[model samples]
Target: MISEPDLVKYLPDCQFGVNSATRLRFDFRNSGSGERVRAPWYRPLCRQDFLRPRTAAMEYPLGRHNFLRSNNLEEMQDVLGRIMCPHRLSYLDKPEPLDAVINSFDLGNLVLNYVQYGVPIAVDPGATGDFYALQIPLYGNALVRSGGKTIISTPEIMAVTDPEAPLYMELERSTKLLLVRADWDFANRVLRDLTGGLLPWKLRFDLGLDVSAGRQCQWFTEVVNLVRRADVGGGMLKGPMWVPQLEESMVARLIQLHAHRYSELLATPAMPASQRVFGQVVDKIEAMPEQLHTEGSLASEFDVSSRSLRSAFQRYLETSLFGKLWHVRLHRAHLDLLWATPEETTVPAVAERWGLWEPLFTQRYGENYGETPEQTLRR
Candidate 1:
């Protein structure tokens, strides 16, 4: 079990305890309420042991099963926190049950885990919503099927499926897997923004889970080690404020690495005209940062009504086109302040270069960057 001092150090506002021999619980609460808003854990016993609603039991896999459950309406929030909370699992829920174990973490935006098993288990997709599930086998072979298309991932193979779409998994013998469940909103938002909101469904990438032999695998193992040590409190706990960003970055890197391996997943069809137009406008603003123009001018240039331009930006970028353009311009100006030579930079000059001629620009810059442009220049 993780030590009390370490738990306190790493997860200051959370409660951690072991209930009976098979249940582990961690309660996460905000600083003010002191009431746990989320409880996420691993359960080794039969599904029938937990007196949950019959509806919950109905969702279990057919025949015998071992699973984990989180008792919180804000389950996503809780799970993400716990996984990324920098704590460790002291004991396996089952002894010699299978070398395979399910390890979960809450990294604020995503909940991720690694499952190792001595015996194979069948998995079926859930009904109701479209979610994202990525499964990568570390040892042995496995078969994953989605929408009648079957993909086989050998030892060190990975595959992805859209939870909104039906899928099935059949493992050859017992195998180990790294499974991740991410918030649909967060995942969709990130991918859509990165892809300019062009793809229809969430993006899925298949990584051949072969980290055991290469630098990629070495990096993966090292990250897992760091996360485990943090969870167990092997003297690596920083404050809570830093945990969320670190966790998010880790998950993002994983997504990026895996996506690089499966670039085909991103090769969907062309984006809609709205997104294309919005992208064009963004490009223009980025290229001509000194041109302080109103949305009306941009709309005129695009030959579309201002209302249409606004609507297009909202749909594609989830923000007004003008707002994004302003943000980009400011971001560029800030970058210049940070990296440009002193002789080539000045607060007022930077502002003018980015078309921030109004007093409000200073306020917005400070709000966004946590420092005024003058302060940045001084730095």
Candidate 2:
């Protein structure tokens, strides 16, 4: 990996025109309604639907994070360079009316950036530096060249630029891309942890990434959720604790979904929570069992991912997170049944008080305590 200073020195100025062009803006239909986007953790998206339904001619992706909208190629180069590593920008085709827009948000060591140079442009970032790039086209197709391989990237077929490699991209005018810029150190740490490897090494991904279905689809869903949260101003990723978890979830999914060198070892059953994360989740659950809970909601509240939270509960408590919640609710309901008379309350009432139905309560109670809720109520 090259140092930042050395990388800057080697890269020359971007060569393109400063031609003025039309400007674009974002549309916020339901800005503060609190019901605009109800995104959860990594809900797999339909293979065909890459962008959210809010995407119209008016609504823009990453509209909330928009910081730069310009036509000057030099200014675009400098501005984008400050956020990402320095790179040379040129024209791949006859430059159409140029109107470049950039919106970026940082999550720990990762950055979710939306970039659209409204023309056919070529980007030359000689060596990718110490960062990985997941380039997913939201609108148009692109020619990706890196590490002696070339692939045509589209909405379904994404492109990944490895940390230590020579990379260039020929983007079409219709291209509106969502780039996930990740620091090599932090991302590699996640891969190492997920693989339970002793040492850290640069994990290389294949040139082309297919988000058509399966884990790749799930990974894209997570990426979109992160971008949506940033755009929606949920303050979810703004917290000190959630930033790391956000990065962890993003990189962990890439490691698990994308093909890599040690992908075969991933099936080796990752180790359980060694840190205090498990206790934190347990305390939250035991503290408030009556609250309406979902795996995604609990994970969000605790600044963790749904999958990680589930893994912790499964390994430590010998049950799922919801399974533990069920026991807590059942215990409380059992006490209510024992203390109250039939005139005061019935089996249905006691079960409903704890967010359970009569039959479910009765079945679970019988399984655990060798009796039904009705029997307990009568006693």
Q: State which candidate has the highest TM-score.
A: 2
Supply the TM-score for candidate 2: 0.62
Give per-residue CA lDDT, model 2, range 79-162, as digits (tens).
Answer: 888888899998777654467888888775888898888788998887768888888887678999988899999877889887
Q: Model 1, 1-379: lDDT tens per residue?
A: 1122333333333333323223323233322354433332233211222212233222221101223443222332243334422111222232223233335654545555655443444554432144455566544567777645677875345565654556666664445555665565555544443334345555554424444344344334434334333343312223342233334334444554555423454344333347667777878877875564444456557655444555566577766544565577778888888887667777877766555544556777888899988777777
Q: What is the lDDT of residue 135 in candidate 2?
A: 89
- RMSD (Å) per prediction: 17.4, 14.5
Per-residue lDDT for 25 in model 2? 20
Score residue 24 of candidate 1 by CA lDDT.
27
RMSD of 2: 14.5
TM-score of each: 0.39, 0.62
